[model samples]
Target: MPKLKVIAFDGTEFDLEAESGSTVMENAIKNAVPGIEAECGGACACATCHVYVDPAWSEKVGQPDVMEEDMLDFAYETKPNSRLSCQIKMSDELDGLIVRVPEQQA
Candidate 1:
């Protein structure tokens, strides 16, 4: 399992354990992390699971695909590091992946 760190809008941090190959949004929902609405599950059809990949981890996380990029337009406070958590798969390389939840979802 990879250890993921999720920072809530209010700056609360959650240290979560996530299975490799699972989506970030999945782990978040499973752990009851707030602000990741994931309204469309992991289908990449909604922007509710919006998060900001910590700058230091942005390159490792990579940029979103066309579909995810389009959907992010609907997210709240989209930033240079904004990403749809459902599109980010967990891996050992992401063991310390850090993301910050937006104050609100789409």
Candidate 2:
């Protein structure tokens, strides 16, 4: 399992164990990490699972696809690192991936 670090809006951090093939949003929901709403369940149709990839892990996480980018427009406070968690799959290389949840969902 890869270790995923999720930082909440209030600065709280959750260290979660995630299965390699699962999406970030799925692990977040499983661990009850607050701030990742995941309203569309990893379908890539909603922006509720919006998060900011930490600068250190940005390149490793890569950019979201066109559909995800289009959905991110509905997220709150979109930034250069903004991404839909559903679009990010966990892998061994992402063992220490870190992401920050937005203050609120769209």
> Which candidate number has the best lDDT?
1
TM-score result, candidate 2: 0.97
lDDT (C-alpha, whole model) for all candidates: 0.95, 0.93
How many clashes does each candidate structure show, in the order listed? 0, 0
Each model's TM-score?
Answer: 0.98, 0.97
Candidate RMSDs in Å, in order, are 0.6, 0.7
Model 2: lDDT of residue 57 = 93
lDDT of 2: 0.93
Which one wins on TM-score? 1
